[model samples]
Target chain A: MSALALFQVVSLFLMAVGFYGIAFRRSFVGMLICVELLLNGAGLGIVAAGQLTEANPVLAQLSTLLVMGLAAAEACLVLAIIIVVAKRWKSVDPSVVSELKG
Target chain B: MQTSALVLFVIHALIIGVGGIMAVASRSLVRALVGLIMTLFGVSGMYLLLNAPFIALMQLLIYVGAVVILIFFAIMLTKAPAGGEEERPNQVRTYLLALMAGVLPTFVIGWVVLTDQPASINAPLETGLKALGQGLMEPYFLAFELISVVLLVAMSAAVILAFKRRQSR
Candidate 1:
């Protein structure tokens, strides 16, 4: 396989790992960590495609930057919510904090 | 690929893989954060290998510096537990289910990628801070400005949410 393909495989594997973590982790913070991993994997795939494919180089860079912005915003908002949930429930376990379940 | 480039790729991949494992599997929250930082660093190095130095720098600065710190602070302030629960007795069944759920789509994607080789773009990245700046301002100005606004909104929302929650208690 070419180097680019190898990198693509690595990023895909990372995404899979992140998915596993999201499902397996018992705590909200751990799931948050997995979410970051998934985001990074997406960024990596974009960077690789930009570097390897015939598409505009700036396009990938721009999209990756946008993804970074999204990630930052997501992190801030989710962490805040996590804090609120912890405050109300006195725990970070998603299973325990599900108060509004139908 | 040049021998040196190949070596660097191997190194970066190893770093990323190991760091990813530590981040996902570690029981301690702080240790998981450390692993995530290592993974981000490796990703930046991959960006360097891709000839996007600016992206690499931004990745290091934004992800490693800002995001990591934010998560760390959240964990610290919340005093979240260090270790999560141990794998339950039905761990194998759950693992199989999760594996099946995660791997199916990935297999389809991998098949498509293997079958359809994307057209390769061999143009060297125009490597100049000025050019990138101009590109961002000229064609992507709307996105640039919008991201700033989005960030501001996110900051305000976080502050309001946290503050309101604290007050309500």
Candidate 2:
């Protein structure tokens, strides 16, 4: 495989790892960490795709920046919500914090 | 040249794999967060290898600086008893669903990679701060402003959600 292709493969592996964490993590904070991993994986994929496609480098970088910003905003919002839930339920375990579940 | 790239790929893959395992398997939330940070760092390295320095930097700034810190604060403020009842799969069906959720994306991505011939990597890194600024303020200017508004709304909402009950009490 080419260098770029190799990078892409590694990126995908990271993405998979992140997904696995997201699937299995029990705590909300742990899941949030996994989400960060997933977002990073996506960012890496975008960068690799941009490298492979020289046609629009600027666009790719801009999108990557946007993703980063979005991830930051998302983390802030989710963390705040998680804190609120923990405050009320006294637990971060999703299994137990099911008051809203139908 | 190819050999060096392959080595880097192997190293990055190992980092991601180990970090992923640590993040998922560890019992401590803080340790899991650390593992996640390591995994993100590996991804940023991969981005650098892909020749997008700006994106890599953003990865560092946003994921490492902002997101990870947010998680840390959550862990600190929340009173969740660490190392409580082991997180068991609540049901067989849920376990199966989770497994499917994890496997489906991997298959889709694998199919795309295997079927599509690897594209050539001839593009030199063209993203500099100037170009990024130009694009952010130009064609995507409206979207950029919109994102700022979205962020404002999200921040205020988060603050309100987190503190509303406290103030009421």
Q: Which candidate tops lDDT?
A: 1
In candidate 1, stretches whose alpha carbon ends up further than 4 angstroms from where it belongs are: B84-90, B121-126, B166-169
Model 1, A1-102: lDDT tens per residue? Answer: 766687788788778878887887777778888899989999999988878877777878888999999999999998899888888888777778766898
What C-alpha lDDT does candidate 2 achieve relative to the native structure? Answer: 0.75
**How do the residues B1-169 of candidate 2 rate in per-residue lDDT, one tens digit apiece?**
3567667767877887788778877877878878887888877777766667777777788778878888889888875466443345356765567677677897798678756755666435556789878988888998799888888998999988987755453
The residue-by-residue lDDT of candidate 1 on B1-169, one tens digit each, is 6788879989999999999999877878888889999899999998898899999999998899889998998779778654544233336876787677568767888778767777554433655777678879999999999999999999999999998835552
Measured against the true chain A, the candidates' chain A TM-scores are 0.95, 0.92
lDDT by candidate, in order shown: 0.83, 0.75
Per-residue lDDT for A10 in model 1? Answer: 79
Per-candidate TM-scores read 0.92, 0.88
* Candidate 1 global CA lDDT score: 0.83
- Give a tens-digit lDDT track for model 2, residues A23-97: 776788878877877777677767677767655777777777777888888989998888877777777778788
Stretches > 4 Å off in candidate 2: B85-97, B166-169
**How many clashes in each structure?**
2, 0
